[model samples]
Target: MSARMTDAEARERMDEITRPEKPFNRFRWTITVALLVLFFGTSLTVDISPSALLALPERTLFYLGLMFLPPDLSEVGRSFNAMVQSLGMAWIGTIIGAVLSFPLAFLAATNLASKPVVFAARQILNFFRAVPEIVFLILLLPITGLTPVTVALALGISSIGTLGKLSAEVIESIDPGPVEAAAATGGGRLQRIRWAVVPQVIPEIVALWLYRFEINIRNSAVAGAVGAGGIGTLLVREIQLLRNWATAGTALAVMVIVTLIVDTISGRVRRRIIRGPQRPVDIGADTLPPDADRDAGPDLPNDPGEAGPRTFAPI
Candidate 1:
């Protein structure tokens, strides 16, 4: 235990440290075997041969040359309009999801809702997450009849799962101080959530919405290919049906450029929201109830006072 030890003592400590038997590297071996199995299984399933692998690069280059040799912009106006439609669908979907997910988040938060409510809300979110957005588009296609609105609705429903789940997590992880203060001031459950919970989580939730919008934009492109109405439909038609490489290239370029612009703007806005004008802003702190601190006084850590059986305190 001394700071300095004799050589014999050091040797004795080393032996003691190394005395336990080392366990087998089962985790490493398991990972290696699983990866091998997956690689071989996928290769067999896809029937990819050594010659095909070697020819992949050459084939890719040949295709690229065909598409972009003299990229045409004859239908540039149409591509631009379709891109706007895709943007519209994405925005509509994001708003719908944002609106729906907000309430579900509260219901799903363990700190806010009862066990039954939480369970039900979470199951709803899970079902949304489990199914792809394409499936929802398919279901809505018949009723809505192949419009951007249908894609928007599908994306909205799809967004609920992720938004709800993430928002719930954000709700649960908020500063407990605000909740405690609300309770101490005799605020009921709803008041506590409104005054305490919303302010803390709103910025993050909005940022998440923006991020989801970026995702929905991409999803819109895929939906368009399946007859939802966007640049995707045009791009696919030019390439597959018309075999017009120039037009296809133009459409593809427009889609990429537009998507990138949206992504860049959204990312900047999300950063601004997260890193607010004041990080962890305490807006209108003067409004806090004066009597709660004065009348109650400072209680011991274990005190169960006006805020009956206090679970959280200001940090």
Candidate 2:
């Protein structure tokens, strides 16, 4: 003989299954309130007012009118040359940073290096990352004497911190199976990294380098404000000294157009790198016998002499 469950008991069991109880997060609410208070406090400290914001549109329009009314065509050649220099500086800087960061990334990676090594490498990267490219340019200007080379060096050194940290994170997130397999096959430290890690991380690292190159172009313009040789130098000279607003506007337009073009190209390349090569998979083919020699097809090399075993050199 079975007993029937009461309606209240059934409802209680259904509630337990369907709607699980959640804990009350007092700390989360407290933090949200604290953040709200801090935001208002900072706004008050900065003396922000609605009246100033209300006047912004009129002021901006006035400046825009001054800049683009006649649209000076006098310095078009000079602006183009300076823009090219900026691109060169950015490209060279990114290359230098990529070269320097590649090895340091392994040291900062937790999966690859000891705690002390990771900590030390991260601290070094942080120091470089904390300093802005403009500051680096300012310091190097005295030694390098206001050349594009100085701007390149500044951007390169500043880029190392961010690049190394991102690369270390990428290295740490890779699957551990390949690394374990490499070790099982008696590969040494460098050999394991070459065979198991470099192939996985190199594409992402190269994409990061291209992304940084786009950023460095803008930074190079900023460096030009301090006479480090770029379109920015032309801009400052025209607007601040000569009071040639139209020329300055032309330079600004050139900067914007070049940056947009580079960004578009780099973005497409990055997406391609991330997505990788696509191969169509056949479900029917996948159901073939497990013992089938898939590599023994006519398309594959039949003789050992035709296809030697692949080998990877240590980095």
Question: Which candidate's lDDT is highest?
Answer: 1
The Cα RMSD of model 2 versus the native structure comes to 8.9
TM-score of model 1 (CA atoms): 0.80
lDDT of 1 at 240: 84
What local lDDT does model 1 show for residue 275? Answer: 70
The list of candidate 1 runs beyond 4 A from truth reads 1-23, 47-55, 278-315
The per-model lDDT (C-alpha) reads: 0.82, 0.80
**Model 2 pairs in collision:** none
Q: Give the range of the ten consecutive residues with the poorest summed lDDT in model 1.
A: 306-315
lDDT of 1 by residue, 1-315 (tens): 789999999898888886567778999989999999999899789966889899999998887888778777676888899899889999999999999999999999999999999999999999999999989888888998888888899999999999999889878888788789878977799878887788778877888899999988898876755766888777778788888877778888889999999999998887777676544445544454666546555441212112111122111
How much is 281 displaced in model 1, in angstroms? 7.0
TM-score: model 2 vs. ground truth? 0.76
